[model samples]
Target: MNTKRLGTFVAAILVLDAMAHLYWLVRPASDPRALSMAVLNMDVPFTPRVLLPLILLLTTAAIAIVAVSRGRGGWPAKAVVFALGAGLLVRGALGLVWSSGLGTDTGTPFYRLNLLLYTPVCLIAAGSVGLVLARTRRTGARV
Candidate 1:
């Protein structure tokens, strides 16, 4: 895809992630334990203290993506986008490994969801961002 389209795709993914965190923050699951296990593969509380920072981070990522895509922000914006892509790539790779029962239990809901949803989304978003970076480099555009 073109750089613009790729950036838009990545930004959408980030926005959706932010929305999901917002949902968790506003309407916590009936069973926080189950929800946490299913989502994070851990027992950590899904409180606003946790979700709020995630929401902010995801929102910032989306904004940075939009700015970079529009060629509005300079290298600093591009750097943020690059960092976001790298972080997603690492998370996806780790998810793939963990979901395969290497680091996490295969029977857990998180394993299934990570394998089916989270991992793929992260990988796709990372790839889209990578494509945008490449296109910008090739075209000599200030993305």
Candidate 2:
């Protein structure tokens, strides 16, 4: 798809993600991490439990606009796109590390959720930003 639509898709995903986190923020008792902690001994803090998702929503909203604006004409657009891609990629890649290779068991549903759900979403987001970044490179080609 074109840059605007791709950005829209990413924004929609971010909105959905934020909504999920919103559910947790509203009903902390029902937060999924509670199960992860109870079953797998992982502890997520308030930063990630609430703030990060809100930040992600805001950032994605900004980046979505940037990604569709003017086809990467300036440093601001490039920076936003790069930051967005990097954040998503790190979320997916680092999540793999975070959930694996400790005394931690990889077979639990917590890890499974990251594997099956979170990581894929992140990678897809990164790919969307990456596409926008790719167009920036091509359009920036010197004569």
Number of the top candidate by lDDT?
Answer: 1
- Runs in model 1 lying further than 4 Å from the true structure: none
Candidate 2 local distance difference test against the native: 0.65
Query: Model 2: runs farther than 4 Å from truth?
Result: 31-41, 47-53, 56-74, 96-103, 140-143
**TM-score per candidate, in order?**
0.94, 0.68
Measured with C-alpha atoms, the lDDT of residue 84 in candidate 2 is 71
Tell me the alpha-carbon RMSD of every candidate: 1.2, 4.4
lDDT of 2 by residue, 26-119 (tens): 6555565675474335775544545565757555655544555346435655666677789889988866775675544676666777767777
Number of the predicted model whose TM-score against the real structure is largest: 1
User: Roughly what TM-score does model 1 have, to 2 decimal places?
Assistant: 0.94
lDDT of 1 at 59: 88
Report the lDDT tens digits of candidate 1 across residue range 1-24: 666777788888889989988998
